[model samples]
Target: MLHVIVVLAGLCTMGMAMPLPDFYSYSPEAGGGTGVMYSTAHEGHITGIRIWEYASAYIGGIQLRYDGNWTDLVCVNSGTPMEMLLVEDEFIVQVSGKHDSGYIFELMFVTNHGRSFKVGQPSGTSFHLFPTHDGSELRFLSGRHNGWGITSIAAHWAVYSSDNSVTP
Candidate 1:
């Protein structure tokens, strides 16, 4: 009985030393692999958040957050970014520039979605919903001038609230 007890204790100690498996029943030698912490977001599928700023058509559309930050995105333009409703799987942003004409627009995604855009057309143009290339935080610029502080209500209604209701 003493020998059996000793063996049991030894087994328990060894088990304690070994790392436990994770949610995936992970084992380094399992062959298939432990997989990654965050799945690579499919570039085409635009979920979460997205922002795009326009610049003379030359700056094109800058997608914020994993897309990019406003400071880094439309830095030179100093435009107003307004959050538009998410239609069909995208978060739209309307960025209007204040500068007379000094284009510094950044074309959307460098990898597979960038080139150039229409020049000098950002003042009253509404760009499309920005796409997310990575799986991190997302940001977009907004213009809340509201034509008379009235567009605020419309802007709220356009965005999807955390509770899943259209914001009022």
Candidate 2:
């Protein structure tokens, strides 16, 4: 029994030493049919984001900058574009949006520094995404985007390890 207790304690300590990613559920897929799936799972920390949106319409496209490299834009760039750059240690803490049966109408990214990037129109069902674990920030994004707009979306959060590796 003592040996088993020691093993369990060791396991608990190991678990505490390594942080894990907190995965929130995906938001509702507003558009019908499965669109092309994309994931921004790269090796560096997120340093910026670009969003393209049609005024009073929907989110048309999105791009993320990881460290110094930018991911390929998902969907089409058919509207006004906005960009947000993060300073060192800044991170996204929340993602709220609105979507309807046909498109994601709005998106807003809130950061730890109290800054936010908001776009698109405000019409449809609402969604708010955030990490449940403290110190975790937006690490990446995964979702399906139709050729026109984002049909579904999800955020991945993690407390980045000291070497900038995503934990878990």
In every candidate, how many clashes are there?
Answer: 13, 0
Q: In candidate 2, residue 81 scores what lDDT?
A: 83
TM-score of 1: 0.19
> What are the C-alpha RMSDs, in order, of all predicted structures?
18.4, 5.6
lDDT of 1 by residue, 25-128 (tens): 11011111112211222222222222334423423222333222222332223344433223343442322222222332221221122221222333332323
Show model 2 residue runs off by greater than 4 Å.
Answer: 1-33, 166-168
- CA lDDT of each prediction against the hidden true structure: 0.27, 0.78
Model 1: weakest 10-residue lDDT segment is 148-157
How do all models score by TM-score?
Answer: 0.19, 0.79
Candidate 2 per-residue lDDT, tens place, 1-168, comes to: 999999999877656533432523233333433589978776677899999987678888999998889998888888778999999989899889888876778889999999999888888888898877766788778888878888877887777666665455
